[model samples]
Target: MNPIATKYIKLNTAIPGPRAQELLTRKEASVPRGPFTTAPTFVVKADGALLTDIDGNTFIDFAGAIGTMNAGHCPPQVVEALKQQVDQYIHTCFHVMMYEPYVQLAEKLNEITPGNHAKKTFFLNSGAEAVENAIKIARKYTGRKAVISFERGYHGRTLLAMSLTSKIKPYKYQFGPFAPEVYKMSYPYYYRTPEGMGPEQMDEYILQRFQDFFLGDVAPDDVAAVILEPVQGEGGFVVPSKRFVQGVKQICEQHGILLIADEVQTGFGRTGKMFAMEHFDVVPDLVVMSKSIAAGLPISAVTGRAEIMDSPNPGEIGGTYGGSPLGCVAALEVIKMMEEQNLPARGQQIGERTMQAFARFQHRFPQVGDIRGLGAMCALEIVKDKESKEPDKELTAQIVHACNRRGLVILSAGLYSNVIRILAPLVITDEQLEEGLAVLEGVLEELCL
Candidate 1:
């Protein structure tokens, strides 16, 4: 039996209860307030699929640290492994003094990261670092200056990552002089298409938008790579169709541009497939990965064909705390847990159930303009007008707040901030999922009314 499931959260009162507020107050005094949160509430302890705040109020956790805990919080096996590693040692810098766990993780990633060819992995501290290294590798390997990322594709927050990321409000608002030469392209988001086109035609139009806005202007060969998210997380769970991915891959291949799948958010079995790229059958030259790779530790990786990953010379990429033995051990255990739990297949099942519930929601709520997903990663992009597909940002916020009030943690995303991204831990129980979904239904009914 699966051992990573949550027991239950006893809801004594509203979320962020009281003790959470105390911690929040403490945090405000101790830490900078900028990177804090737009989302309300605070957490104290999380185990499996449930979170108990400091005030003793328990809430069902659906955010799952932005989909970083695929195996659930403090899974016994992973926790045990971490404890054992803490006893042995913590940090020795994997690059300075080699560790078996790091090597073991690399070996596992090389074998599992969506390709049969000879592959390699470079570990880092976060998704941004992984993405930065990927861009560096692509540029070095191809000897090019320009990179092509998609609209609404979020890479990370570093200068280069922000440059690669497309949203501007807060992520790139004041951060200027972003790494120059990085360009944006069109991704296949079916909901917000320019009116009067079928799905296929819209996809082609976006493809043309790429070649026209990019290749028509800049020399394709000069572009080093095109980074993408298979099922965009923060940009709304926009699952680009198989054909759309194939079309983009063809364009990149034709232009001698390497495809960089930024599976940082969608990889590590969040999608039904191990890697989201597997759904499209397109093998990227470089795949940037992170998030749940180490269960919850701050570790990420860029895994790809040997040639590209090998382009960086010694001392070209690494960090002081990147891929510590603890993180590496956590990653190894995560992979083992996923395989044992058959998380990829389980993701499909969860997606099916979640989608069915969303279908019922759509039937009842006119605001639910679109419901899309790949696996446990699913979402509903609220719209003011069904035909116009205008973003109902206000309504989306209300829905989110309502969900939080009801003791179910939910998250919001999208370019216009109108999409609710549902990224629960894979270990959440059917009972807990149903409870959360019911709360979601109440929120939808309450807000959409």
Candidate 2:
């Protein structure tokens, strides 16, 4: 570990740490109304994979800012680059005037993404913007009006993003009149087994369902794109089988429809691979990436075959804050950090460690139900009955709260909210991870045993 990351704080009381509680009070008075906070602690500062609360208690970071900061908190190279770029310039709309960092980062993304074919990239300020722009590009390129997305997949919070996203209770309950021409498909989640369906049954049911839609409801040629996450994120850290992913690719190819891989959460070394799609041989025509790309500096992009990307007319895709100098500089440094640390390989190693740690829990706790994941990204779906595999949402939430009290912050997902998703920073110390997992086991014991 670097000198900048060796510092650790001591915990003395219930989290909010007194000072954080005061800040939380001030936040209720001044902060925006929409942002919902999960924890009682208010951070004073963060370094490496640890966050210091207002009272100076340190907590191991597991959320990674919802899949950002994969390079870990305030990575030295990225922070230094941000500092240096601040002295130059902040924003100059790329459409009005080009900048070196933007062009350079785009080049890096194009070259690094899975493809040797000619490709181009467009920068955006957020993941939602990138998804929205991808729709524009796909529509322009294919001259089609319909798009298909998977169930339980999370795109973003924008109006159109809501339509593309499939979760109803939380993401889409009252947000009506979302963008039109968006269709939904079932994501391949093997844990719950969908209607008590087996793997082979699930595969056939999903395929036949899509075929029915294509033949009965909509014409395949009218479909512009089918957007999917290589590995589902917020919906659950569901890792689709190689057969399922390849089957989807085949369907898209048969209809001449474009395939869009939403790697916003899975990209930038979240999975063992740089992009989650690398686990399989399937190559998508377009790849949407964000979150950790810039190591938390708010940069996102859509990259793929140049010919399709070029279909958009001038002024079709550009943002004032898109690909800011600081963001691009941060991204370049993030890439350098990944190379220097071999983070992708490290991600694979972390996955192995997670498996080892989780296996012990599986043996002791029958309610573990299922343990599934890849690289540094993984999740365990809890159950009411191990044999029945019924979603135990209440149990999962209890486990999360217990873990929080133990100083391990974890996030939950899945269609029924019974899954515990773990997305730790790829650079977290092995000792921290082991300690966090041990706390997590204790939380499970309290909830299940």
Off by over 4 Å in 1: 1-9
Q: Write the per-residue lDDT of candidate 1 for residues 1-449, one digit (tens) a residue.
A: 11122335466765666766777788889989678464456666788888776677777888888989878888888999999999999998977788898888888999998779999887899999999989999999999989988889999999999998989986889889899988888887777666787789988888778767664667887899989888788888888888889888998988889999999888877888788899889888888888888778899998889988889899988889988898999999999989999888877887889999998987788889889898888898899967778898998888888777667788899999999888788888899888888778877766776
Poorly placed runs, candidate 2 (over 4 Å): 1-9, 194-197
lDDT of 2 by residue, 1-449 (tens): 11122233246677766787788889889988678665677777878778777776777777888889789999888888888898888877787888999889989999999989999998998999999999889999999999999988899989888899978877888879889899989877776676667887887788878888988878999999999999999887888888888899999999999999999999988889899998988999999999999888888999989999999889877888888888899999999889889998888888889888888887778788888898999888888778888788888888877666557777888878888888889999898888787778777776677
Candidate 1, which ten residues in sequence have the lowest lDDT sum?
1-10
Sequence-dependent TM-score of model 1: 0.95
User: What TM-score against the true fold does each predicted structure earn?
Assistant: 0.95, 0.95
Model 2 scores worst on lDDT over the 10 consecutive residues at 1-10
Q: Which model scores highest in lDDT?
A: 2
lDDT of each: 0.84, 0.85
